[model samples]
Target: MSEHDVEELKGVFDVLSSQIPALIRGIIASVFSEEAGREMGKAAGAFYKGLIEAGIPNDVAIRMTENYISVFTNLGEIMKKLSYKMEREGKIKKEAEEEKGEEEAGERAEEQ
Candidate 1:
């Protein structure tokens, strides 16, 4: 890609690098906060109770409850992974741009 294209890409990545982290942090905090924890516990208990009332076996009810809780945890994990990957990609792009700039400067110096 041309230098101008790379620079534009760098700007986009920089914006994403900042915004994505803030979004991820907000999501993670909300998911794991004390209020969220309490709500999750209540919800899981209600699910388990409902299953038991419906004549589901104790083991099955427990498993379902575990799965229900996993949904929230999984969301948090996915966001964390996405944030890490974006951060890593941004760093890689920045490093590549820096290296290309150095190479161009060196070539100019040799021609002078």
Candidate 2:
């Protein structure tokens, strides 16, 4: 390949490499948010139970339950986003592998 072609390929690779960190961060954030939400729900339930045993008002207990439900709902959304991101990443990796295989096949053919 010509020097110009090599430089162009390198530039493209550099751009892809730079974006990798951001992609990974988004995926991690999505997963962690979901996990944290689950933990929060458990803690909130325990708190509500304690409050009830301690003779807290019915209104206060209802409000606490609502808040916990809201947190779980938000967590469900985050998990959905994470699932989509992971699926997209899987497709990208599969395509890359296929392209690499084709390139290797071409090189072998040329050698023969």
Candidate 3:
């Protein structure tokens, strides 16, 4: 190939190499930002419509919202702890069963 074609190919390669990851990052960030914005908008609209429009005091609404969020966060923490406990219990049960099986096998071997 001619030097001019080689140079053109290098230019294209350089652009793709530099731009592809940047484009991907931009797209990912845009998607995440859009979704987050949509969620916040929906939450805000619901709060405004339900509480603020219903003539609830703005300070009361804010406090209620914070309390509501705290409740959910606490619930989430409780659920997480329960989930971990269940998982540990499951693992312990499995290990105990395995040990029992090993002990039974050992007794059979001794009998033989």
Candidate 4:
């Protein structure tokens, strides 16, 4: 890779180092046990190996892998929050539909 590419990869690694720990903490809290944390680390390592084997420079691969973890972690938070919001909206809509149905049924009975 060119010098520019190396610098960009270093930047990515810096960003990852700053962000990934918090992301991992959040992920562990939400989905994985402490034991699973170790496995997750190993899996990330394997992914880095695959990237290197695919012709990515080792340093660049490692850096990008760290950034990838951070990106995924942020993505997970966004998705989780979105899902929660959707579920809440669905519940609200269901409740409104039920209320409307009850009102209509009462009106029909009264008319009859």
Candidate 5:
């Protein structure tokens, strides 16, 4: 590729490197937010009620609702794990001074 093409690719990567982590963090926050929890609970309850109305067994409806909730929780967990992995690999910055401050605080607590 030409020099111009390489420079354009690098610029794209620069923007993406900063934005991707923030996007993932935003998604994780939204997914686990209290409002989301309430909405999920309502949706699950409605689903279970609908199933029961259709003559599904109570136990089976409960199992289906549990599975529905698990899907949301699992997605949040996966994103959280991905964020941690990126931080560890230095794909996302953890800020050196922040980490040092946390470590020192932990050491002080341990001595207490």
Candidate 6:
């Protein structure tokens, strides 16, 4: 991908990062909210109906929808893992710098 593509991809991830918490909250609410689940079911049904009406074969439509959802959700999952890795690396780097600073202070005290 070109540099511009990389940046646009990063923007997608930045949006997901902010929405992750709300997504989690929705998941939790769905457990106790029958209306929410029913609404989502209706939405899915409409999507399939629309696809069939568009002349896509039944089997192909189902498979296409499944693939689309799988890949889209995996994109967010991939970003979550990447963000976790970057955060872990940042913590490790911070700790290493702190230790180095302490060692330098110790050496200076000893030299005096």
Q: Note the Cα lDDT for every prediction shown.
A: 0.89, 0.73, 0.67, 0.73, 0.83, 0.69
Q: Which ten residues in a row have the lowest lDDT in candidate 3?
A: 23-32
Q: List all candidate RMSDs to the true structure.
A: 2.6, 7.8, 19.4, 19.9, 11.5, 9.5
lDDT of 1 by residue, 2-99 (tens): 99999798688789887887788888889899999999999999999999999999999999899989999999999888888877887787789799
lDDT string, candidate 3, 22-77, tens digits: 55455445534767558756775686568988899998888877775556446545
The residue ranges of model 2 lying beyond 4 angstroms of the native Cα positions read 1-54, 57-62
Candidate 1 TM-score over all chains jointly: 0.77
Say which candidate scores most in TM-score.
1
TM-scores, all candidates, are 0.77, 0.48, 0.57, 0.52, 0.74, 0.57
Tens digit of lDDT per residue, candidate 6, span 1-112? 9999997986776566555645655554553367855765676678778899999999988987777555645655665566566556656655786899999999999999
Model 6, position 74: C-alpha lDDT score: 67
Error of 5 at 96 (Å): 17
* lDDT winner: 1
Off by over 4 Å in 6: 1-44
Q: Write the per-residue lDDT of candidate 2 for residues 1-112, one digit (tens) a residue.
A: 9999997986776566556545756755654576766876688788789879889897998797788677756766765666567667756876886899999999999999
TM-score of 4: 0.52
Instruction: Pull out the clashing pairs in model 4.
Output: none
lDDT agreement of model 1 with the native: 0.89
Q: What is the overall TM-score of model 6 with all chains considered together?
A: 0.57
Clashes of each: 0, 0, 0, 0, 0, 0
Across 4-104, the per-residue lDDT of candidate 5 in tens digits comes to 99979867866666677678899999988999989998999899999999999999999988998899999999999887776554443436646877999
